[model samples]
Every structure is written in C-alpha cells, then in structure tokens.
Target: MGKGPMGGGGPHGMMGGGQKAKNFKGTMKKLLVYLKPYSISIFAVILFAIGSAAFSIVGPKILGEATTTIFEGLVGKVTGSGVGIDFTYVSKILIFLLGLYIVSAAFSFVQSFVMSGVSQKVSYRLRKQISEKINLMPLKYFDTKTHGEVLSRVTNDVDMMSQSLNQIMTQFITSVTTLIGVLIMMISISGVMTVATILMLPLSAVLISFVVKRSQKFFKTQQEFLGHVNGQVEEIYGGHNIVKAFNGEEDAIREFNKLNDQLYNSAWKSQFLSGMMMPIMTFIGNLGYVMVSILGGYLAIKGSITVGDIQSFIQYVRSFNQPIAQTAQIANLVQSTMAAAERVFEFLDEEEEDQFAENPVKINNPMAGVVGREFQEESNKKSHHHKEAEREVAVVNEDEIIEIEGSVQFENVHFGYSEDKIIINDFTANVKPGQKVAIVGPTGAGKTTMIKLLMRFYDVNSGAILIDGHNIQDFNRHDLRSIFGMVLQDTWLFNGSIKENIRYGRLNATDEEVIAAAKAANVHHFVKTLPDGYNMILNEEASNVSAGQKQLLTIARAILADPKILILDEATSSVDTRTEVLIQKAMDNLMKGRTSFVIAHRLSTIRDADLILVMKDGDIVEQGTHTDLLAAGGFYSNLYNSQFEDSHEEAV
Candidate 1:
C-alpha cells in the first residue's frame, strides 16, 4: 500500500503496449496445444472420421461392381451365355453394401461424440485459465480496460472458439480422408479419369487460398471493432452522471454513433467474407464433378474404361472433390479458432505476483485477550511462521508507536505509473501518523496519489517508507492494509445483505459484532427499523440502499475492523447536513486512537483537525493548527475565511 488510497498505482494511467499478438502459424501451434489435454478424445474423433471416410468409398465401389455384375448377367442370359456369371453372388454383394452404410453412419455418430467432448472440454479449460488470470491481475490492468470489454473477451471470443471446434476438426479429418480414399479408389477404377480430376483441383485451390487470406484480414478488423464498441458503451454507462451533469449528451451520443458505425461496417465485411467460403467451395466442387463425368464417360466410350467402371469412377470423383471443398471452409473456422487462441493466451501471459507466500500475518479472533489461551494459541502460530509477531503484539494493545510517532515518513521516494510522468514528484512527507492530517488541493494535485504511495500499491521508483521502524515493502500487503481502513468518497458495495457489506471488513465477525459495529456508526437503529432488519438485501454497488446508509455501512465496516489508521476522503460530502452530524460522531469514534488522513472539502471539518496542510498544484502551501494558520493569515487563513465569506452554503 504505497501511501496511496488503495493498493493500486492510482487509477489514472493508460495501458502501455502489451504482448504482440501471435501470427497465423504461431496461433495454430498454440491452438493445437489446447487439444493436447484431450489428445485421446481428439484421436478417437479423427479415427472415427477416417473410418467413415474410408467406408464412404466402399459404397460407391460396391455399387459400381454390382452394376457390372448385373449387366454381365443380363448379357449372359440374352446371349445364351448364362454360365458367364452367378446371379446369387450379386445379391450377396448388395446386401453386404447395405451393412457397410449402416456401419458408416454409426462411426459418424461416434465422431460427433468425441469431437464434442474435445471442443467443449478445451474451451471450458481455457476460459477457466483466463478467469483465473483476471483475478490474479493487479488493479492497474483494469484501469486501462473497461469491465464490459473484458467481459466480451471472456464470453464472445471464447464462444467463437468453442462453437467452431467440433465442426472444424471433424470436417477436416473426414474431408481430407475422404479425398485421399476416393482418389485411390478412382485411380484403381480408371487412372485416366483420376488424372483429370487431379488436374482441375489446383485452380480451385489457388482461388480459395486467396479468399481465405482476405477473410482473415476482415476477421481481425471485425474483432477490433467489437472491442471499440464495447469500450464506448462501458464508458458511456459508467460516466452517465458526468455526461448528464456537464450537459455533454450530444458529445456522448455522437461518440457512440461513430463507434457503432465502425462496428457495423466491419461486421458486414467480415460476414460477407466468411459467407463467401461455402459458395466458392460449392462452385469448385460442382465444376470438378462435371469434369470427372465428362472425361470418365468419354474414356468409357473410347473403350479405355467399362461403363460400370466409369460410373464408379465418377462417384469416387464426387466423393473426393466434395470433402476437399468442405474442408476448405472448415479450414477457415480452424483459423478463426486459432485467432481466438491468440487472444486468450496473450491474457494468460501477463506476469502476476505470486499470491501464496510462506509467511502472512493472521489476525485471530479480535476480541480474544492478548494473554488468553485463544491469543496465546494464535500467538504461538504467528511467532512460529510470520516472524513479525512481536511488533504486532506491542501495537495490538497500544495506539502509538516510537519511530513513526503518528508521522508517515518517506526517506527518498521516487515513483510513477510507468517511466511516464511522475505523479508523486519525488514525494517526501512527514505526515504525523494518527494525526488528523487534512490534505486539501485541486483535482490531480497528488492528493489521492499520496494515499496510493503510502499504501505501497506499487514499488517506489526508489527510496524507503517507514511505519514504526519497519520498511513498508517488507510487510504483507493484506496484513499491512489491515492496519488501515479506508472509506473512499465514491463508495462501492457488493450485492448482498447489508450485514454482509459491513461484515466484509472482518469476514468472520459474529452477528453481534456486526450489529455492534453498526451501532458505533449510528446505523444500528436505522437497520432495525427496516423491513428485514439486518438481512436487508443491497443491490449491486448498493444502489438499493440510500447514499447515506451506504456510507454508514462502510463506516460500520471500518469500525468493525478497528484498524490503527483510517483514511477518509470526502467522507461526509455525499450525505445531507443532518446525516453529516450523525456521521460526524461516528467518524470521530472510528478515528479515535488511530492515525487519520482526511481529504475533506468543507473548511469546518479541517478547522478542528490537529494539522491542516493546505495543498495546491501537488505541493503544500501552508501547515499548522487551524488557529495558527489563521493567525499567520496566509493561504490556510484565506481558505478558511473563504468558507465563511463564500455564498452557496447549501451542503458540503
């Protein structure tokens, strides 16, 4: 928690360039790796497809053989050469062909089963990995990307990969296998016709290849346009209040329409390109079929092949060319899945700090006595593992410390969101810890940035921060933060009971403890007066609850945690004056015996503060107690006098 408001490199920075996306070949290789986990299932799918393809050629072969046998029998009877062939053998052959088709159908079903499992499992696993990465990512990542855009990646992109999996893989195996098997059968039946079919293929292949490359370009653009549209919506909805307050509705509408227009154009092109595959493939397949029929029939008439042989050769030719055409389109889907894989893998590649450390501070039952059996048991465990138990023990019972003396001391801190503009400006401050330090300044005056630095959200560019005698970097982030409770001006709460919102401060706290915390924050009576009492449900971000209660709930949360430091940024600015008075008492109770960093707007709040540091342009202009600063009649005095001298005293 680098003296910042929260554990983040204050959320003001843009995303730096991320990992370059993998190209087509790289994407295909990575896509293949997802199949590695389901190799057995994929292998089965392929095998079934191979069998189905191989069996397909058998039907046409048998039909051609039967046609020859039947014609031979007819010629024998008519020519009085009945002994030339046996009629019963042809009957048996036809029956055998019937059995073969049934088997082919069965194998086709098994192929579907195997491919479905492979695709679904792989997609599920990849989504899980991406979800885990999102959790492990630092807050800085979310600062650049909106929740909705990120949400789209997880859902739409992943679904694209999953949806095409079975179709692509199964089609690939069947198409390629059928093409090879039928080609071999055709060669045996009539080599002349086989040569002719092969000759006509290269033209169609080259045309499809050109179209595929074009399609990929459109697909890439289509994906980017989607992200842009998602970004626009996320921003517009998230900043709805800002748009309304500033009366920039026209500007917002125009921006949204621009993004939406681009999305529509890109989508149309992408769909058109993808839709071209089937038409292009079918045309080529038909042209090849016509070529085989004409050439094979001409060869038979020229006594180069038998009529039955020509018929069978034509069937094999259609079987062969048909799958090749289908495979071309399936190849496009395979490529798209590879593209999705590139996106998914890029997310997982981001480096995350290791979460599971060997030693972390554990706060036992809070109400447990320092020397009681429960405390001793927890103490023994802490001393055995964390190694900072001694200091924690001393601070547990006392409010003050020696080295820090309610003062946050920065030795020589230097930091930035990146190597870009430095926000802290070689920040060094002797903020007396536990002192009511009021930081007042204009927006972006490094006010909230100061809180982020002290919290150690990001490692300082250089230097050390000491709390007590300990450098902050050595402390566990969660444990260190447990000592300070922060209530931001913009409050956020989860969708749950009001009790759970307050209980978030101490997850294991009892109902009684929760009620006690609420009472301390003057919210107990109000909650009891409600229909559900403590069990009342709060909507997402606590929108179901009033603004004042939301703040009070957070205050209760802080009181429950009972931290040594409290951070209140415009804590009372959101509620009415009557609620403010009620909350002021609660705030005082929560701030007692703790170091408080207060970012207050009302001059009345700071007048009572132990130290009022007037900040402007990211630097302190004046510092002293309220009276002393007013006596000097400098910047602090002017800011103080302005409140009384100023009009529009509606509320904070």
Candidate 2:
C-alpha cells in the first residue's frame, strides 16, 4: 500500500500535523550527501539489522519442530503404539529457539546503539553549519523573513531530521530482511498457501495508495499554517505591551485561532489516514492466516507436507504481515523527514556575503596608524609618507600608514533598496577628521540609510565610501567595522549583569575600565544606588531599569569601545527633557575629538554642529553651519522656524 503523509510522529502522535515535502526525491538525495561521512557506521548498522531479522525469522520455524515432537509423542502414547513423548528432545528444541531469540535481541540492541550515535552526530554537524551560516547570511535575509520562521527551521526542522534518521534506517533494513526471509520459509513448506497469502498484497497496496494521494495535500498545508501560527505568536508576545496599549489582544487571539484551526483540520485528517494502516493490515493478515491454515491442512491430508511444516508455514504467514505494515509506516515517516530536510538545506544554500579580498587591511591598533610589519616588509621600498599623487592604486594602504584618521568621504554615491526605486541618488559629502556632522531630515528621507552604507552594512549601488583615503570596501569587513562605534535609537541589552552589559563593547575590559566608562556616561551614581550595584542582573528586556538608564548604559558601552568614529542615531530622543540634557552632556564628552555622525529629529540639538546637512526626498537640500542655514532662509530655515514659530511670535 502507498504510505500516508508524515506528520508529527513521536509523543504527540496523531494529534500532530503532517508536513509533506514538495520535492521528496530531490531532498532525500541531498540529505544522503550528509550521511556520506557516516557510511561505515551505517553499514555496520545495516548488518546488525539484517542479522537480527534473520534470527527472528528462523524462530517460528524452529519452535514448530518442538510443537511437532510433543504432538507425535502424545499421539503415540494415546494409540498405545509402544512409543512415548520425548520430553528431553522437546526441551532441546525449545532451548535452541530461545538461544536464537537472545541473539536476535542482542543484534537489535547493537543496531539501535550504533544508529543513535550516527543520527546525533549528523544533527550536531548540521547545527554547527547552520550556526556558521547565520553569520555569513546578509542582513537582507533577516529583514525579509520572520524570526519564527528562521527559528523553526533551525530547531524544529533539524530535530525532525535527527529522529527520523534513526527510525528510517533501522526499520528499512529489518523490514526488507524479514519480508524476504518469511516469503522463502513459507514457500518451502507449502507453495499453495504462500500464493494465497501473496495475492492479498495488491489489495492492501491499492487501499494505502488511495489514502496517501488524498492526504499529501493536507500535510503540506499543515506545515504552512504551523509556521504562520508561530510567527503570529512571536509577534504578539514580543510586542505585548503595544498590543495592550492599542487594545489588540483580541485581534491577536483571533489570528492565532485562524491558523490553529487550519493546523487542526489538516493534522487530524493526516493522522486518521496514517492511523488506518495497521488495522487494515491486520485484517489482510487474518485473511491470509485463514487461507494458509486451510491450504496447509489439504497438503497434510495429501501427504505432501508434515504437521510440523504446516505449523511453521502458518507462523511465517503471521510474521510476514508485520514487516509489510512497518515498511508502510516508515514510508510515511520518510515524507516528513524529507520535508524538514528541504528547509534545512534551503537555509544552508542561501546566498552568503561577498568573499574577503586577499591581503585585506587590518587595524592593529585603534589609536595608532602604524602599518603591520608584514605589509611594510612586502613593500619596503615604499615610504611611510608617500605623496598623495604617488599613492599606489592596487593596495588599500599604499601610503604605508595603516592608521585610520576618522576622515570619511562619500563620492558620487547612488543607492536603492531595490533596482527599480533609487532612494539616495548621486549624494556626495566629505567630513574631515575630528569633525561632528549632523544629518537632519524628515522621516524616510534617507538619514539612517547613509549611516548603514557608511558601516558597509549594505554596500552602495555605486560610488565609493573612502576612509583615510581608501575605499571602505577594500578593507576586511571585520577590520573596517572595528574602527567605528554606534549607539542606535533602540537600546539592546541582554540578560546579564549591569557590568557585563557595559563590557559588551570590549569583552576583555577590566572592572575598572567598565566603571570608568559608566562614570563617563554619567550613570555611575545611579548604578551605585541599585541593590547589587554593578552586579545587578538585567532581565531579557532590561525592563528592570528605566528607559533613560538603559540609554545611559548603551552610551557607556560606546565609551568603552573607544572607536575612531561614532554614529549616534537620535540617542536622546526617547528620554525625558531632564534625561535628554544628561544624555546630551554625556554625548558631548564622547564626541570630543572624534569624527561623529549625529542623526537628529530635534532641530534644537544641532545648533552647534560643525556641519548640518538638511535632507529632503533623499537629496541634500542644503548644508552649512546652523547660522549659515538660518541666514540662507532655505528649506532648513523653514523647517527650523516651524518648530518655534509660536514661541518666537510670543517673545516679540
């Protein structure tokens, strides 16, 4: 019979959904590639499974000999033919049969032991590859896919693969072995009985195939709905406070119920179809059993077969149906596993970021500009201070100084999130070392997008971002990013001690350094008042602290990083006026003598910026010092005046 689609197969049993794979054959082939390394262990497992099945297949036949011996002896005694029962011979046969069973059990145990190791190791390796793949994937992937979907693939899908692997291999070998051995034993005793039993196979196959075809679609639907449910739950829980504020809990529950209902409809149908396999197989087996009994009796009456042979053949008939049923069950499991494998392999094959260039630049010291000895030795003939006109174009540090001066320039840049829609077009700007540049714009005017490009989080569609007279892309991504520190609007603090959160900027920093950074950010006194001082643990959301205090902790982190360049994206926007003043003071200290890019929504904050670039519709509409822009009376003037027009008129 064709197999029913596979759903969740372990303790959840029929209640679980069946997730059918679209490309079963292709996915299985890819999965086998991973098993190549464990081939030797798998081969040994196969041998053990075969041996175990072989021994079990011989047991019924051997036990029949003892049955026959006891019967003959009893019959002779009843007929008074001077022959009595041979208890010793009967006991010997029974002992031999028991020995065979013990051996079979041992083989089965060995097979299970070996296969478990193989499955777990394969799972371990796949998890490692997936972990590494996460780092290689571009930010675009995370942006496009939900957190729940990615997490399901990594955890649920990988786990499915591991459990299914253990079951499929051992069951497959044992089923085949038992099927073939039972057929041979049955035929050796009575061909007519064997033929009768074999005739029912086609009928069972027809029933199973019909059910399988109908169930496949439901299984596929089940998985899709399951993912949707997970995504909705994750979204609702993550933003539960927002949901509560907006009175959206009912809507969230409604959405979850819809997805859950879809899952239930598909799950029960797939479960019912698969659950029918064994009962139907048992009916077919009973039919074969009755037919074998009648046919064997006729053979015995014709003197063509002995009583012992008929008994042995009957046992074979019963054993034959079991493996047939097991094979069908395993077939269902195969579909589920293939579906999971497809997802895992799809994730592994995702496009990775561009490869690192050979001899990429390295920033050995944050404060110094000295080139590595290797670079200097290779180009020893070049002087440390080569004239700008004489600089080599082939290498990033051709001028021999590997130091970053924090000077940044965007030359004729053009960028778009997609090809058809350009956002920032032909924008160019230059910031000299140790200058504070403020970018002010309306929402969606490409202020933050520029910072992303500057960090090489996403490369520009065209044109170059140069740092210290070298293109940012020319340096290793790790080395290039190390020179800059960012404090974004959304503060990220993991569940750890307060001190540990601050030390995230520099993992190896000492306690003294961490305390100094906290003092610099003006949060030291507040932390000292806490119950545990710096040792106080922050929960997952860091909700134990106020928003302003969380902002302070992030500022302290940036201070500890001590980067050559700093990017602040509205670092004070979320706090109260008093807290904003404190944050501004801390920021001023942090920005001292460091090239900084500040993205501000409040016009008042950028009044003293060295340069102010007012943005409109992805273009820089005006750029100058605040006073120069006010004197010019351009778009910047209108935007700045709009904020305080009422106050200005009242003062007049």
Q: Return the top candidate by TM-score.
A: 2
TM-score of each: 0.78, 0.88
Q: Considering only N, C-alpha and C atoms within 3 Å, which residue pairs clash in candidate 2?
A: 1-205, 7-18, 369-403
Runs off by more than 4 Å, candidate 1: 1-35, 66-99, 146-149, 164-168, 209-270, 299-311, 354-408, 425-434, 528-536, 648-652
lDDT of 2 by residue, 1-652 (tens): 0012224622323322355678888887878878988999999999999999999999988887887787788888999984888989988888899999999999999999999999999888888778867875788899898675687677877888898899899998999999999999888777788889899999988886786677666656765665666667877888999999999988988988988898899778766776766677888878887887788788888988778887888788878888887787687678768878888888887876642545566565533233233333433343211112322333555454376789999898889989899999888888999999999988999998899899888889998999988888877556677788888888999999999999998777899999999999999999999999999999998999999999989999999988899999876767799998889888988899899999987889989899998888888889999999999999999999887996788889
The weakest ten consecutive residues by lDDT in model 2 span 382-391
lDDT of 1 at 267: 61
User: lDDT of all predictions, in order shown?
Assistant: 0.70, 0.81
Candidate 1 TM-score, C-alpha based:
0.78
lDDT for model 2, please: 0.81
